[model samples]
Target: MKIFKITGEFFLAVLKRTAFSFLDLMKIIVPVYTMMTILSYTPVIKFLADWLKPAMKIFGLPGESALALILGNFINLYAAIGVMPLLHLTPWQTTTIALMLLTSHSQLLETSVFFKLKTRAIFLLILRLSVAIMVGLLLALR
Candidate 1:
Protein backbone atom coordinates (compact mmCIF):
# COMPACT_ATOMS: atom_id res chain seq x y z
CA MET A 1 0.00 0.00 0.00
CA LYS A 2 1.90 3.09 1.23
CA ILE A 3 5.17 1.15 1.27
CA PHE A 4 4.76 0.12 -2.34
CA LYS A 5 4.08 3.70 -3.39
CA ILE A 6 7.20 4.94 -1.58
CA THR A 7 9.32 2.19 -3.10
CA GLY A 8 8.07 2.99 -6.58
CA GLU A 9 8.83 6.69 -6.14
CA PHE A 10 12.32 5.95 -4.87
CA PHE A 11 13.05 3.68 -7.82
CA LEU A 12 11.79 6.26 -10.27
CA ALA A 13 13.97 8.92 -8.72
CA VAL A 14 17.01 6.64 -8.94
CA LEU A 15 16.32 5.94 -12.60
CA LYS A 16 15.99 9.63 -13.40
CA ARG A 17 19.22 10.46 -11.65
CA THR A 18 21.04 7.66 -13.39
CA ALA A 19 19.79 8.79 -16.77
CA PHE A 20 20.95 12.35 -16.19
CA SER A 21 24.36 11.23 -15.01
CA PHE A 22 24.77 9.05 -18.09
CA LEU A 23 23.86 11.97 -20.29
CA ASP A 24 26.44 14.15 -18.59
CA LEU A 25 29.13 11.54 -19.17
CA MET A 26 28.11 11.07 -22.79
CA LYS A 27 28.35 14.82 -23.33
CA ILE A 28 31.99 14.68 -22.39
CA ILE A 29 32.96 11.36 -23.97
CA VAL A 30 31.20 11.39 -27.35
CA PRO A 31 32.54 14.71 -28.62
CA VAL A 32 36.06 13.90 -27.56
CA TYR A 33 35.88 10.49 -29.15
CA THR A 34 34.64 11.94 -32.40
CA MET A 35 37.34 14.59 -32.44
CA MET A 36 40.01 12.03 -31.73
CA THR A 37 38.68 9.86 -34.54
CA ILE A 38 38.79 12.76 -36.96
CA LEU A 39 42.26 13.71 -35.79
CA SER A 40 43.40 10.17 -36.51
CA TYR A 41 42.38 10.63 -40.15
CA THR A 42 44.11 14.00 -40.50
CA PRO A 43 47.76 14.99 -40.59
CA VAL A 44 47.30 16.98 -37.38
CA ILE A 45 48.03 13.97 -35.24
CA LYS A 46 51.21 13.31 -37.19
CA PHE A 47 52.36 16.88 -36.80
CA LEU A 48 51.69 16.77 -33.07
CA ALA A 49 53.53 13.50 -32.80
CA ASP A 50 56.55 14.90 -34.57
CA TRP A 51 56.48 18.08 -32.49
CA LEU A 52 56.39 16.16 -29.24
CA LYS A 53 58.79 13.43 -30.26
CA PRO A 54 61.75 14.80 -28.35
CA ALA A 55 59.77 15.12 -25.11
CA MET A 56 58.26 11.67 -25.58
CA LYS A 57 61.72 10.20 -26.15
CA ILE A 58 62.48 11.01 -22.52
CA PHE A 59 59.70 8.60 -21.52
CA GLY A 60 60.89 5.93 -23.96
CA LEU A 61 57.63 6.19 -25.86
CA PRO A 62 57.06 6.72 -29.57
CA GLY A 63 56.07 10.17 -30.73
CA GLU A 64 52.54 8.95 -31.47
CA SER A 65 52.09 8.22 -27.80
CA ALA A 66 51.54 11.96 -27.42
CA LEU A 67 47.99 11.45 -28.63
CA ALA A 68 47.25 9.10 -25.78
CA LEU A 69 48.73 11.47 -23.22
CA ILE A 70 46.87 14.44 -24.64
CA LEU A 71 43.57 12.59 -24.76
CA GLY A 72 44.06 11.24 -21.28
CA ASN A 73 44.88 14.61 -19.81
CA PHE A 74 42.30 16.72 -21.60
CA ILE A 75 39.47 14.24 -21.93
CA ASN A 76 39.51 11.11 -19.78
CA LEU A 77 41.25 7.80 -19.39
CA TYR A 78 38.57 6.05 -21.43
CA ALA A 79 39.21 8.47 -24.27
CA ALA A 80 42.92 7.73 -24.06
CA ILE A 81 42.27 3.98 -24.03
CA GLY A 82 40.07 4.36 -27.10
CA VAL A 83 42.94 6.07 -28.93
CA MET A 84 45.66 3.72 -27.68
CA PRO A 85 45.31 0.75 -30.05
CA LEU A 86 45.47 3.05 -33.04
CA LEU A 87 49.04 3.92 -32.03
CA HIS A 88 50.17 0.29 -31.60
CA LEU A 89 52.14 1.05 -28.48
CA THR A 90 54.48 -1.45 -26.92
CA PRO A 91 53.66 -3.05 -23.58
CA TRP A 92 56.17 -0.82 -21.81
CA GLN A 93 54.78 2.26 -23.46
CA THR A 94 51.26 1.23 -22.52
CA THR A 95 52.29 0.76 -18.92
CA THR A 96 53.94 4.15 -18.84
CA ILE A 97 50.87 5.81 -20.29
CA ALA A 98 48.63 4.03 -17.84
CA LEU A 99 50.72 5.21 -14.93
CA MET A 100 50.70 8.77 -16.18
CA LEU A 101 46.95 8.73 -16.68
CA LEU A 102 46.48 7.35 -13.20
CA THR A 103 48.18 10.43 -11.88
CA SER A 104 46.44 12.96 -14.10
CA HIS A 105 43.40 12.15 -16.24
CA SER A 106 40.03 13.83 -16.73
CA GLN A 107 41.44 17.27 -16.16
CA LEU A 108 38.30 19.21 -17.02
CA LEU A 109 35.96 17.01 -15.04
CA GLU A 110 38.24 16.70 -12.03
CA THR A 111 39.13 20.36 -12.08
CA SER A 112 35.48 21.30 -11.99
CA VAL A 113 34.95 18.96 -9.11
CA PHE A 114 37.87 20.48 -7.28
CA PHE A 115 36.58 23.97 -7.95
CA LYS A 116 33.25 23.08 -6.43
CA LEU A 117 35.14 21.93 -3.38
CA LYS A 118 36.79 25.40 -3.06
CA THR A 119 40.23 24.19 -4.14
CA ARG A 120 42.60 25.76 -6.64
CA ALA A 121 42.13 23.87 -9.91
CA ILE A 122 45.29 25.12 -11.52
CA PHE A 123 47.44 24.06 -8.61
CA LEU A 124 45.93 20.62 -8.59
CA LEU A 125 46.36 20.31 -12.36
CA ILE A 126 49.99 21.35 -12.19
CA LEU A 127 50.68 19.00 -9.27
CA ARG A 128 49.14 16.04 -10.99
CA LEU A 129 50.78 16.73 -14.35
CA SER A 130 54.17 17.27 -12.76
CA VAL A 131 53.90 14.06 -10.77
CA ALA A 132 52.84 12.14 -13.85
CA ILE A 133 55.79 13.44 -15.87
CA MET A 134 58.23 12.78 -13.08
CA VAL A 135 56.99 9.22 -12.76
CA GLY A 136 57.29 8.70 -16.49
CA LEU A 137 60.81 10.07 -16.50
CA LEU A 138 61.78 7.85 -13.57
CA LEU A 139 60.32 4.79 -15.22
CA ALA A 140 62.18 5.60 -18.42
CA LEU A 141 65.45 5.62 -16.53
CA ARG A 142 64.88 2.07 -15.37
Candidate 2:
Protein backbone atom coordinates (compact mmCIF):
# COMPACT_ATOMS: atom_id res chain seq x y z
CA MET A 1 0.00 0.00 0.00
CA LYS A 2 1.16 3.59 -0.65
CA ILE A 3 0.41 4.51 3.00
CA PHE A 4 2.57 1.66 4.30
CA LYS A 5 5.38 2.61 1.91
CA ILE A 6 5.34 6.23 3.09
CA THR A 7 5.38 5.19 6.77
CA GLY A 8 8.32 2.87 6.17
CA GLU A 9 10.27 5.60 4.42
CA PHE A 10 9.55 8.03 7.23
CA PHE A 11 10.75 5.56 9.84
CA LEU A 12 13.94 4.87 7.93
CA ALA A 13 14.59 8.55 7.48
CA VAL A 14 14.18 9.17 11.19
CA LEU A 15 16.52 6.32 12.01
CA LYS A 16 19.16 7.61 9.63
CA ARG A 17 18.94 11.15 11.05
CA THR A 18 19.26 9.84 14.60
CA ALA A 19 22.35 7.85 13.76
CA PHE A 20 24.01 10.83 12.06
CA SER A 21 23.23 13.08 15.01
CA PHE A 22 24.83 10.62 17.39
CA LEU A 23 27.90 10.37 15.21
CA ASP A 24 28.23 14.15 15.10
CA LEU A 25 27.93 14.35 18.87
CA MET A 26 30.64 11.75 19.28
CA LYS A 27 32.97 13.60 16.95
CA ILE A 28 32.64 16.76 19.02
CA ILE A 29 32.82 15.05 22.39
CA VAL A 30 35.78 12.75 21.87
CA PRO A 31 38.50 15.39 21.53
CA VAL A 32 37.25 17.38 24.48
CA TYR A 33 37.16 14.21 26.57
CA THR A 34 40.70 13.33 25.63
CA MET A 35 41.97 16.84 26.37
CA MET A 36 40.26 16.87 29.74
CA THR A 37 41.88 13.56 30.64
CA ILE A 38 45.33 14.89 29.80
CA LEU A 39 44.70 18.14 31.63
CA SER A 40 43.55 16.25 34.71
CA TYR A 41 46.99 14.69 35.09
CA THR A 42 48.86 17.95 34.65
CA PRO A 43 50.63 19.59 37.61
CA VAL A 44 49.21 22.95 36.54
CA ILE A 45 45.73 21.86 37.54
CA LYS A 46 47.00 20.83 40.98
CA PHE A 47 48.87 24.07 41.48
CA LEU A 48 45.92 26.21 40.45
CA ALA A 49 43.54 24.25 42.62
CA ASP A 50 45.84 24.69 45.60
CA TRP A 51 46.23 28.38 44.84
CA LEU A 52 42.48 28.87 44.86
CA LYS A 53 41.58 27.02 48.08
CA PRO A 54 41.47 29.94 50.51
CA ALA A 55 39.22 31.88 48.18
CA MET A 56 37.11 28.84 47.27
CA LYS A 57 36.63 28.19 50.98
CA ILE A 58 34.39 31.22 51.20
CA PHE A 59 31.92 29.43 48.91
CA GLY A 60 32.50 25.98 50.48
CA LEU A 61 33.58 24.47 47.17
CA PRO A 62 36.22 21.75 47.20
CA GLY A 63 39.66 22.43 45.79
CA GLU A 64 38.95 20.28 42.76
CA SER A 65 36.06 22.55 41.87
CA ALA A 66 38.42 25.45 42.11
CA LEU A 67 40.56 23.84 39.44
CA ALA A 68 37.56 23.79 37.12
CA LEU A 69 36.70 27.38 38.00
CA ILE A 70 40.21 28.62 37.36
CA LEU A 71 40.42 26.74 34.10
CA GLY A 72 37.10 28.17 33.03
CA ASN A 73 38.17 31.66 34.04
CA PHE A 74 41.52 31.69 32.27
CA ILE A 75 41.15 29.33 29.39
CA ASN A 76 37.73 28.71 27.83
CA LEU A 77 34.28 27.78 29.13
CA TYR A 78 34.70 24.44 27.38
CA ALA A 79 37.54 23.73 29.80
CA ALA A 80 35.01 23.64 32.63
CA ILE A 81 32.53 21.73 30.47
CA GLY A 82 35.10 19.10 29.66
CA VAL A 83 36.10 18.64 33.29
CA MET A 84 32.58 18.14 34.64
CA PRO A 85 32.43 14.39 33.85
CA LEU A 86 35.67 13.93 35.78
CA LEU A 87 34.31 15.80 38.83
CA HIS A 88 32.34 14.27 41.68
CA LEU A 89 30.06 17.27 42.21
CA THR A 90 26.35 16.69 42.60
CA PRO A 91 24.02 18.24 40.02
CA TRP A 92 23.04 21.14 42.28
CA GLN A 93 26.61 21.75 43.33
CA THR A 94 27.80 21.51 39.75
CA THR A 95 25.25 24.05 38.55
CA THR A 96 26.14 26.47 41.31
CA ILE A 97 29.86 26.09 40.71
CA ALA A 98 29.50 26.32 36.96
CA LEU A 99 27.36 29.45 37.20
CA MET A 100 30.04 31.06 39.32
CA LEU A 101 32.72 30.17 36.80
CA LEU A 102 30.65 31.36 33.85
CA THR A 103 30.00 34.73 35.45
CA SER A 104 33.58 35.67 34.56
CA HIS A 105 34.78 32.87 32.34
CA SER A 106 37.86 33.36 30.15
CA GLN A 107 37.92 37.08 30.72
CA LEU A 108 41.51 37.50 29.66
CA LEU A 109 41.14 35.45 26.52
CA GLU A 110 37.77 36.89 25.70
CA THR A 111 38.86 40.43 26.34
CA SER A 112 41.84 39.98 24.07
CA VAL A 113 39.68 38.40 21.43
CA PHE A 114 37.25 41.29 21.62
CA PHE A 115 40.03 43.89 21.90
CA LYS A 116 38.53 45.42 25.00
CA LEU A 117 40.05 47.80 27.50
CA LYS A 118 42.96 46.55 29.58
CA THR A 119 42.69 46.03 33.33
CA ARG A 120 44.39 43.96 35.99
CA ALA A 121 43.29 40.37 35.39
CA ILE A 122 43.81 39.50 39.06
CA PHE A 123 41.55 42.29 40.20
CA LEU A 124 38.78 41.05 37.96
CA LEU A 125 39.37 37.52 39.10
CA ILE A 126 38.92 38.46 42.75
CA LEU A 127 35.81 40.51 42.06
CA ARG A 128 34.27 37.66 40.11
CA LEU A 129 34.93 35.22 42.97
CA SER A 130 33.41 37.59 45.46
CA VAL A 131 30.22 37.85 43.41
CA ALA A 132 30.16 34.11 42.76
CA ILE A 133 30.56 33.30 46.46
CA MET A 134 27.82 35.72 47.40
CA VAL A 135 25.45 34.12 44.90
CA GLY A 136 26.49 30.68 46.07
CA LEU A 137 25.93 31.68 49.69
CA LEU A 138 22.47 32.97 48.81
CA LEU A 139 21.67 29.67 47.08
CA ALA A 140 22.89 27.70 50.06
CA LEU A 141 20.72 29.77 52.38
CA ARG A 142 17.69 29.10 50.20
Candidate that would win on TM-score: 1
Return the TM-score for each candidate structure.
Answer: 0.71, 0.56
Weakest lDDT window of 10 consecutive positions for candidate 2: 113-122
Lowest lDDT 10-residue stretch of candidate 1: 24-33
Across 93-128, the per-residue lDDT of candidate 2 in tens digits comes to 787787787677777776564445556656666677
Tell me, by lDDT, which candidate is best.
1
Each prediction's whole-model lDDT (CA): 0.87, 0.71
What lDDT is obtained when candidate 2 is compared to the true structure? Answer: 0.71
Candidate 2, superposed: residue stretches over 4 Å from native? 1-32, 35-54, 113-129
Clashes of 2: 0
Q: What is the lDDT of residue 80 in candidate 1?
A: 83
* lDDT for model 1: 0.87
